[model samples]
Target: ARRRLYPKPFPGIPYNKVSANRIAGDLPELIPVIKATNEYSTSMFAISTQRLRLPLAQDPREIEDILVRRGREFDRAPMSIKTLKNFFPYSFMGKYNTPEVKEQKRIWADAFGADFLRKVAAPSIYNATLDLADGRPFEVVEDLHNATLDAIWVALVGEEAGITRHEIKKFLQSQRDASDGGRRDPGPPPRGYLLRREVDYVSEMIAKNSSSGIPVLAQKLAAYLPRHRQFRRTVDTEIGLVMRKAVDRFQRLELGRLEAGENDTCMMDLVLRRKVLEAKKLGRPLMDPTKDKVLLDDTFLMMFASYPTAQTELRAALKVAFPHPTTPSVDELLGADIPYLDAACEESLRLAGVAKGNLRQTVVDTHIMGHFVPKGAEIFMNYHVDHAPYPVDEEKRSASSQAAGAKLAAREGISRGDVSRDLGSFEPRRWLVKDEKTGQEVFDAYALPQLAFGGGYRGCSGRKLAVMEFRTVVALLVLNLEFLELPEEMKTLKASETIFRLPDMPFASLRAL
Candidate 1:
């Protein structure tokens, strides 16, 4: 069966290459051929002719059923530890699902739950949008990224990182440099490079202080005493000073709120309360300062993990949805409704395809798609294949048809030629109210797209928070400013795929209308 379906591998298909460059630039053309091949191999085995060795899934549901329902049978896919280690050295400090880590995750999940997200996080996100759109033409992606990062930072740290627009540009450059082999280039690096170097320096200092009897301050000073270390030391010292200030600010603010009978609802406050409760239950001494340090570090890591992905998705959504416009208007956006924005977000996530694939190592020999996947054999869920567009079910087709008829009737006076042929193609109206047919209401499809947040246990824990952030920022942007196209030189942007998606270049020269 495997041999018959793909007897002759399609050669010279430029879209089959799975490199980042190809996936971003050439995916649309390659999708149809891949879908056809996938359908042919549904009841049979087949080998991909693509250089990337990508196996096509028949549909998104097939991948979800296996990954979500049969999750225990598979584990995280293999990653180059050497590369990961460089970025996250502390990952090896403990087991992946240690009790401590689980507890920490639980706290974060609880704090970022639906209610808290709507209340505490949403307002800040809304405000960030206002701040970014204060009467200037700015790169939508860059502005939105910084705003999202700022909001998330405030939620996590209880204090702002004081992120400036100039700093955002600098940080993006540094991130690009780090990802694109720029770190290896000879010469003095940018300030963002120096900032990371300082972080590494301080991290070493903290580790030395932990193990030895030396005080943290003394260790920090010693590390920075050398002449070449002056600049790096200043960076490290400033960060340390800021962190301490943030900690102090949190303590006073939280204590004051408690005194005034305010609820302990913020994430940082929750972490502190949990630590206090556990200490009392265990009869352990209170160590507020030490606990604060732990919370700060974890918060920093979470911010790093989260912000870029939000930014990338926001940028991609805007790029696809408003290809020729500066930005969509607020009234235009709100009238479209939540479902349209949700679909747009889902589509961007699908196309962006952050994280190469879902990693799962088989725990036992399993017959997946009739292939004898051996016990201990590694399996990867190719998200790209899963998200590729395909035929819809009957129910979906009916809903879509109803929506189309309604839309046509509403615009009765307009020519049919002016109507859109592809309703599924980034049409926010598809999610809005259906057209009225003879005073009868026609509805759009309810089958929501399955991208952005993965479903099931291992799905992104912060999905609610992410959605709130995305919606607030997008809505605010549409309300306050127009999203004009950046200058051509600033338009050729690239994406850097880490564990999450980030832009490889800044989208500058966007003017606010």
Candidate 2:
């Protein structure tokens, strides 16, 4: 039992030998690192002897190969699926590279494709951000969340969710009611405000599942607790809400209430249209979102994952925006001609590091960096290697890994360039270069390592949408308002380890331009 409980390392990789003795495994050593950095990736080698024998890879080349090149050998890790599946079983995040998942990805790709983003989503995001220009003091994170949620809601549901607007109006009315109209406090609701039903549901789900150390177990045992019971109720209610919306949309299209011809208004409409076409092609009945678990789950996942990622990136972008003495105008921003804005957004993604790392499971006997890894072993690729200074013991690496690294190093003209310098600094200009032929500065994404969204075929599906939202919000905010320097108390870089690394206190003061 003891031998089974405390296992040894998988022979060819580096791990803390001391960690193999304890039943808790490397958790004792890992806790401090997580508390200090709020990230799972570390400068130290990973030590795990718990349920899964895990290995951490820090070298960029090895990490890139695992994510991009060796798909047949590695799949999304079970640890990740275990946590995410409890909350989103039908979402792609919880599934392997199955045919159904591929189809879902295709649908999601179309939903967030270039045409949909530029034509259908951009205007909604723009209008949503316009609400942020109110010179009143607001919590940066909360307000950004509201705006992002509203934007995504419009894109998903084809109506003004009005979350941001509703909150702003509620705050103003409460101020009037409280006779505190003269005093504009620069924090969250001084007392507290009622959360929208949808916001409450989403918040509770993320908070419960992401914060728990053992999400799957917690979910299974949740029925015994009151708060967990409430969570279950909330989840059911939200599911019902989603089902009703889907049914309404399908009924409208069927009854001819909604003008046909590719109801290009929102994702829900687009999905209904696609299903209708597919049904026609197959000579079958239309699939209902209420009955189709994939449709329902993916729709909910769209709303769940959309805003948080953008909100985290936006907070980071706000920190780096308008660093220059002169800021650009709204016209310049809207024209999409500014390379600095693009650079700043990319820099923010790197600095913020919302997704600290990615996890993959070995599907068969394989070697990472020349180290032998067996099937079902978990490999974690930390993004810190992209920017942070970490020790690399070349002697510990496998011969094949060394040879690959040498080959990569010898490649002419392939370099990180400015990104290799000032590893800790936020210099957006590092991503900009002069186009020799045009004599104009353009954003060069390849100049730096971009693992923020991961890579390969399974990379983040929402990368385009996230970047578009970040750029739009950052550009508009920089163009129309001045972000006052945050006080020391409000400027802590420490973040909570949630679904994303959310800044604990993302507060800011804005002055309308």
Give all candidates' CA lDDT scores: 0.47, 0.65
Model 1: lDDT of residue 56:
39
Clashes of each: 9, 0
- Candidate 2: the clashing residue pairs are none
> Which residue segments of model 2 deviate by more than 4 Å?
32-52, 178-215, 223-262, 310-335, 384-386, 389-417
RMSD of 1: 13.3
Among all windows of 10 consecutive residues in model 2, the one with the lowest summed lDDT is 189-198
What are the per-residue Cα lDDT tens digits for candidate 2 across 1-513?
Answer: 777898567886655677777776666766676557654443234433222256777666567666766777888887777766755667887798889888888876777787777777777777777787555666788788877877777777666767677678778877776895465543453111222344446446554654344546765565456764564455445554655665565555543443353557776666666676566656786665556666666766777667565333433444454345454333434454566778888988887877777788888987765567888888777664335535567765555556666775665533335456775667777787777666666787766557778877777777888888888887767655667777888876667655566887887777765
Candidate 1 ranges with C-alpha deviation above 4 Å: 1-59, 78-101, 165-265, 287-297, 310-337, 354-356, 385-425, 429-449, 485-513
Per-model TM against the reference? 0.57, 0.81
Cα lDDT tens digits, model 1, 71-179, are: 6665544332222233233432112334665666776776777766655555555555566766555654545555666677566545454443445455557778888
With candidate 2 superimposed using the best TM-score fit, by how many Å does residue 223's alpha carbon deviate from the native? 6.4
